[model samples]
Target: MKPFKACSCRDPETKKLLGKQCPNISKKGHGGWYARYEAPKSADGKRRQPRIGPFDTERECKAELARVLGTAAQPKAHDERKTTFGEYLERRYAWRRSEAETGEGLKKSTLDAEREAIDLYGKPGLGHIKVVDLTDEHFRELYAAMRKLNRPDEKDDRSEILRRLKEARATRDGRRLHSRPISEGRIRRVHAVLHGALTDAVKLSKIRPDNPTDGVWRSKGGKRKQGRAKPLLWTSERVEAWEKTGTVPAKVMVWTSEQTGAFLDFAEATEERLYPAFHLDAYYGPRRGELVGAEEKDLSLERKRLHILQAQSDDELDDTKTEAGYRQIPLDDESVRVLRAWHKQKLRERLQWGETYRDAGRVFCYEDGSALKAEYLSSRFRILLDRYANIRAKAAEGWPADRIARKFRTTEAAVAAALQRPLPPIRFHDLRHGAATMLLAAGVPIKFVSEILGHASVAFTMDVYAVVADEMAEDATRRIAAFIPRQNRLSAVGASTVPSGG
Candidate 1:
């Protein structure tokens, strides 16, 4: 490859490139220099010769040539530079697959989530941009666009949604009139996936000099402004708002102690088959995966201990999500009693199944002793909540208890014993939040709560439940004030009226 001058100077009649053959080729301003070279082999093992540019002087062309040559010389660097972000993600790279698939890396679920994020937001927004040319601004723009992205309605078909999006793009006002906007938290997760991929590219392949994502703040004002949503207690005002609008204030909402008790009472009265599981979840806050993954040997009713050594994701049982998740949790007396009763019931079930029982040995299982899926547990919880909610609503309307139970396929006795107060809707995972809140409210040490919940750090546990901690602080002050005998003490607002006994 070499750098040389060329021109458009051509024969008047022929109208073809003259190169050095033109009459005006010797003129100072006749032509510019060009850097010409054969590019490195592509991923398919093919190389192509190319002309890059025409410069006023040979020096500029030579400089360009040097840079191109240098990049091409580095192993795989030229290919990466030519590769778009979308192409890189789609390629069968070693770093992209799960450990199970390749004997080394991310879990299949985690990888699937990453690919989904990339396809949904990353590919549409910046996938066409070359990995080598990616800048912080590109990522910032993508995140900004994602923050404004609206969630499609359940009834909105894909093609209709696409048409609306296309129309929005063509309109003067680009706002998407859809359902609620996608949460900033979810966008941040998408950011995390892209950022991780870029980081891996830089470290493992040297595809880019540095990760552009590193320069982009997760949100406009940083993490403090994009704070995590703490689990808010379903206070009366929030509950009232939810009942009227069918909307909860925050993503994470916890039931109060009274509400938790009401739910447990309802579940027990209904003779819910999974009452023991619900009790354990509400009391200990094990993740849904952990709850469904619990083996029969993991529970020690006599010792009041439940070991969370593994967790289920879909139907696959594996190690817990994190190292801290493998810790043993102390069970309360009530939880122990519930499990003991459940164990006896399971014994009777085993006898009934006899030789044909699936014998999954799970703490919670189907009637045939097959393992219960995490999703099934969540679905069942929702059904229970719906029935409980409906029955309670009818009871408030002066309907007979037996009639209400019959309508919802629950027991007449259960309906009769149901608490009049409404049980606010919450995700099954919120039971975990409620457990943490109850522990914090009951004055359990934050460290203990962290351990019980299998949080990686006490600091994180404190940060998540900081609101609960603040309330606890206020309660402490009130209790201390009431405990102290301060009749002659100075008032809080002003000095004491009575003279001090000097």
Candidate 2:
């Protein structure tokens, strides 16, 4: 080919481009596939050293060029194997994606996420680095890079950054791109992916003694500042206001959230064809979807118990949140009243529209007496928020449905928005927390609260319930005040009479 230079022209299609030199490559962005060149770009009259790549960053560009030119500069620690991080990732990605044709663990959502992560952080930050070279230090670097690459602006999150992270982590890009810090959950995922890949590399004799990620990280929740870990909740006054008017969406949402305990409870409580949905959730706490998908007869009124047999989730009507989510709960008085009212109401609806009601026979139904969908309930919750804009205005507050949607989780948001704005606002899920705190204040056991929240371990419940437990300590002094000994009995408790061990 004619000597390549700033102005020298070649068929854009014919000239092979490497890394940043590709016309299609984004300057600060990433795009479709391009291969590494086997030789450096020719520098016209200058007798020169190798030109790594057209990349802006010399480190990554030069390293990639070393891989293309010869085996001489391969990984110093594992040079005999002759591999680089980027090359390994490319290969692994191809293999995992190829599994889709064979119908393996291929999922559209996952693939889409991986593609987005690559586009933002690129394969270099994730898959291309050497396995043996990876260290906890490297993970910190990767996480920092990832953080730099995206904005935590609520809008950016809505744009799918988290989804992409999920996909990227599942695949080889499992390493953190920036050490700027990430959630423990995100870091854990990266460690898992790294360990898996490195373990395989070791088994295949591609590396030495161990998977470097081993014991480097212990899994935990996200450390990133995504507001807070706790869910939000509304206040009682706001809830009562909405209940009185039956017009404001915020008030309606507030009532449902507090009354139900969680969003799932609201969904259950409001289920039409599946009447008495809340009976199951309020007492046992199945998800809104689980309640929505339940049959009219799923719960046994005569048995005075509800069965959490299965759950309809974000995916399918598969297994519930876990085995813990599938248990029987005896109805409390309130649960019984609500369930009976709903059942009786549903029976009247059925009489009014027999054939229509028989269609799904879902206990949770719409005005038409047809089974209700989770999305419909979610929408109704929103409608309630909009209808009460005046009430929200009067309270110097407003709903945040759009804001909630960006989080990829919203029932919690609705419940939170329903709360009247306090001195410092409270999140909807905070209602559940408030309930737990109240229970703790009331001397209820941690194990009981944990079971209500559907936590698998009591220790986990206690750890999360720590703050509420402290509230109980405050009451300790108050409770002990009643037992303070009488003044007459205190005369014998003089300091001189008490033996001093010291």
Index of the highest-lDDT prediction = 1
Count of backbone collisions within predicted model 1: 0
lDDT of 1 at 126: 76
Candidate 2 lDDT trough over 10 residues, lowest sum: 249-258
Candidate 2 C-alpha error for residue 89, in Å:
7.6
Candidate 2 RMSD to the correct structure: 14.2
Give Cα-based local distance difference scores for all models: 0.77, 0.49
lDDT of 2 by residue, 1-502 (tens): 1112121234467775453365644434443322243232233543323332344454555554444444322222234244655565556556768885566754544544454444444354645555545556665555544443334442344334345453454535564444244545554444455555566665653454446556555333333334234322234444456456643332112122233344333334223233244334334445666666666667777776666666554434545665676666566777777778887876786688867555565656675665566666555544443433433343344445554433333344443443433222233333345555555555667777666655688787666556544644454454477568667656766766878895
Model 1 per-residue lDDT at 197: 74
Off by over 4 Å in 1: 1-34, 37-50, 53-75, 79-81, 91-93, 96-104, 123-130, 133-181, 210-214, 217-225, 236-247, 348-356, 469-502
Q: After superposition, how far is residue 345 of candidate 1 from its true place, in Å?
A: 3.1
